[model samples]
Target: MADFKELSRLLEEILEQGPAGCGCAVARNGEILFEEYHGVKDLESGEPITADSVYRQYSTTKVAVCTGAMMLLERGKFLLNDPIYEYFPEWKDTMVAQPEEDGSYRVRPAKRPILIRDCFSMAMGIGYGGTDYTHQAAEKVRAQLRANVGEYTLQQEIKAMAEVPVAFDPGTHWLYGFGHELVAGLIEVVSGKGVGQFLKEELFEPLDMKNTGYHYFGDIRERMVTTYLLKEDGSREASPYFQRDELFEPEAKYEGGGAGLFSTVRDYLALTQMLACGGEYQGRKIMGRKTIDLMRCNQLNEQQLKEFRNPYLEGYGYGCGVRTLMDPSAGVNSSVGEFGWTGMLGSYVSIDPAEKLSLVYMHNLFPNREAYIHPRIRNIVYGVL
Candidate 1:
């Protein structure tokens, strides 16, 4: 058995310092070594956070949608190198933006077609939300998507994203963008089912991850945690996003793959446990062990990994929507084969195949990169063992 007293003390240190609340768990060889929650779920009501408290997973939702797509890959439903245009024809004419010395960018034909692997690896030149001139194109596309959130289907939104000029040529440079959103749409197209339905049938049901979903509703609404923003004064303020009535509704207005989904620490542990167990949980095979190996493998080369941005991804290799540790020194006391990603709201998970260990730490703080929860928790987790 693993003693997590040090880990608990570390979580308490941060909880008292700033964050409104936190939830953490660790599992080894299908056994939970440590699981604990602290602080309040709602500041106003002073509701306590329990294992069942639901959280908006943000980008951490990528692993779930990617896992769904990887199942299709294991079934031989599609080849990774297959051009996405084969499914969404609108992207066949996709263009890339090339920067000039004058601080201007010119649109040109893509060097090559975007492939399914590009989407999974985030090498397709997809981008995230930004407000500067450099990100104007992606932001416009995102704004359009946000404006029509509930109106368009997943496929429709993907097509809209295609209309935006790509940041770079496919496979040239790596950018942590909305590839998972495209993957979510791809899953729907390949599986002949809605994204939510496919996940329910393929993953949530089998793993018994009942509380995980693209949307919140019913009695689960009451269990949803309040979102918070760390203020300049070192205090936290509740984000208005979670205070809305529709936020806790039964269905989502938009099923964004890049950053969507609300889940509990327990449910997410099941998902991680499946990956840690090489795509199986409790005798149920969610995906092939070989396929899981491919997901953990480094998918980028020297040049691509060099260009991979995002401070948290330092010393890691991009692979199928997850970050694989390419060098232990580049990460926080990690094994060379560990892989995982974090959410924008401070939720993070890591699976170390070398050690057969899985860790999940959850919280509700924005500007997650600045929060430093991921590295702190990771260091403590590794320090204990």
Candidate 2:
């Protein structure tokens, strides 16, 4: 058995360092073994963190979006290899950026059309504003996205991506950009419903994830935690770009499947538990066992793995919007087949099928991603186990 006391202590150590607050839970065989909350939700009001505290999910939203895409795949709406141009014909003529000798770039026709699986594997050449350094073509796309973060609709964003050149041919390289956003658009195309609606009907309702959604409502606004940024000198301040008031959008102009959602730790736990249980939670089937099996397995090749560069994901492989434990020794004491992803802010979830365990740690901090938190938590959990 894992040392619940020690695990709590380890988390307390992190909270001691000053991150607004955090909520964490560990489960095995769909039963909560250890769970805790620490610190205050909002420093201004001094409200305590609770199980129902809503958190900005950031990139962790990809997992849920990708899950919905897998459900679409299971329904035979489209094959993995099918050209996505059918849904968004504007992408049919997209180009890859080729560098020129004059410190410029030339746009060239893509060797092949983007495949549906490319989105899941993150092998799609699409990129975001955050990764402008990856390629000149991506820089252009990033610039556009940055300028119009909330102005564009999901479909408009997809169209905008098509206009920008790609860094490489689809499926030839791994680039974690706007692939999940495209996946959300694809889901909309097939399901004939908004991404949020589809998730609510297919996932939240069935899983009883009452506190999970693309936007907040009612008392949820009160419980929403404030996000912060821990400076190099250890002082903390609220993130200017991601304030609580900014999140209160009257309507979601861009339900970015890549990075836009709010969820509670317990609600996220239910989702992870479903994944750990092989697509079933409390007798309700969210997805097939084989589909969950496919997600936990590595989907990247040697070249794709080599090209995937991120310190946090150093020893991981891309699966369906989640990181697969490709090397047990290379990761944070993670066993092989452990699959999950972290939010841009400090939030993580990994379901280890080998141990029949699910772990969720969430906090609202922007610049303070707490690089050591995920691995430390993993080590503590596995150490006690």
Candidate 3:
């Protein structure tokens, strides 16, 4: 057993410096070595965070979404190297942007078509943020989302994204963009079901992740934790109440995968545990051992590594929707091949297959202070082991 005193100290440190309420759990080989929560779920009522507290998973939702898609790959639904346009049709022979001397980009024919692997690896060239062509393409989809809330669908939004020129030739560069949309879209097409429905039937239900999904249900609203805005003066303010759809509602207004999914610490730990434990939970196998292996393998190349330069991800390599530790020297005392990804609200998942160890940390803070918070949490979890 590991002494989790340092981990507790981190919970205290975050309350003082970041989120109002937070929770963390560390599991190894199906056994929880450490699990703890601190502070209040709502500062106004002083209601404490418990095992039932649900959170907006933000980008941490990527791990599960990718895992769900990988199950299809294991079943031979589609090959990663296959072109996405084969299924979507519109994405076939997509145009690429060329940069000119006037600081503007022009459209050009792509050397190679966007492959399914490129979407999984975020190399599909759809930019999630920017003022350029990529932004316009993605933003048009978002504007439609804002314009027709509760009625617009991800299928519609992703098709809107598919209509524009790509940021680069597929597989030529690495940019954290809207590739997961295509991944989920592929799942919808191949499975002949919505992404949320397929995941619920295939991933969530099998893993017993009762509180995890794209939309909330039952008492989840009452149990949901509040997200906060941490100010520079070390004060935290409550963010506005976010509107949520009812149980079994279609998530036509929300972004699927990374930007969607409401979950709890316990629910998400089940996912990380399954991945770290060779895709098994209890007696059931949600994914194959080698399939899990392929998902975490580094997919980026030499030039792509230079482009995947996230600040907290200095020593990592881009895998299928997750970051795999590539340089231990540059990492935060983590193991080589340690793979996971964080959410927009400071939630994190770090999986080490070598030890069959994994960590799930959750907090509700915008600007997700990953540089200061995540590395410390990861090192503290490792320090006692």
Model 2, 264-322: lDDT tens per residue? 99998999999888888987878997988887677788889988746777778888889
Predicted candidate 1, C-alpha RMSD: 2.4
Ranking by lDDT: 3, 2, 1
For model 2, give the RMSD to the true fold: 2.5
Model 1 C-alpha lDDT versus the unseen true structure: 0.81
Residue pairs in clash, model 3: none
In candidate 3, stretches whose alpha carbon ends up further than 4 angstroms from where it belongs are 141-150, 241-255
Q: What TM-score does candidate 2 get on C-alpha atoms?
A: 0.93
lDDT of 2: 0.82
Give the Å error, residue 141, model 3. Answer: 4.9
lDDT of 2 at 296: 68
Residues 1-385, candidate 1: write the lDDT tens digits: 2247877887888876566788999887799989999998988899889998988888888989988899998888888999999988999987887778998888889989999999999888866756534368766766777787645666767877777778888877777787788899889888998888899898998988888887665668788888887777777888876434353355545676787678889898888988988777887878887887888788887888887745777778878889888876665588887898888788899988777788998887766543366787777777767
RMSD of 3: 2.3
Candidate 3, residue 254: how far the Cα is off, in Å: 4.0
Candidates in order: C-alpha RMSD to true structure? 2.4, 2.5, 2.3
TM-score of each candidate?
Answer: 0.92, 0.93, 0.94
TM-score for candidate 1, residues paired by index: 0.92
Worst 10 residues of 1 by lDDT: 242-251
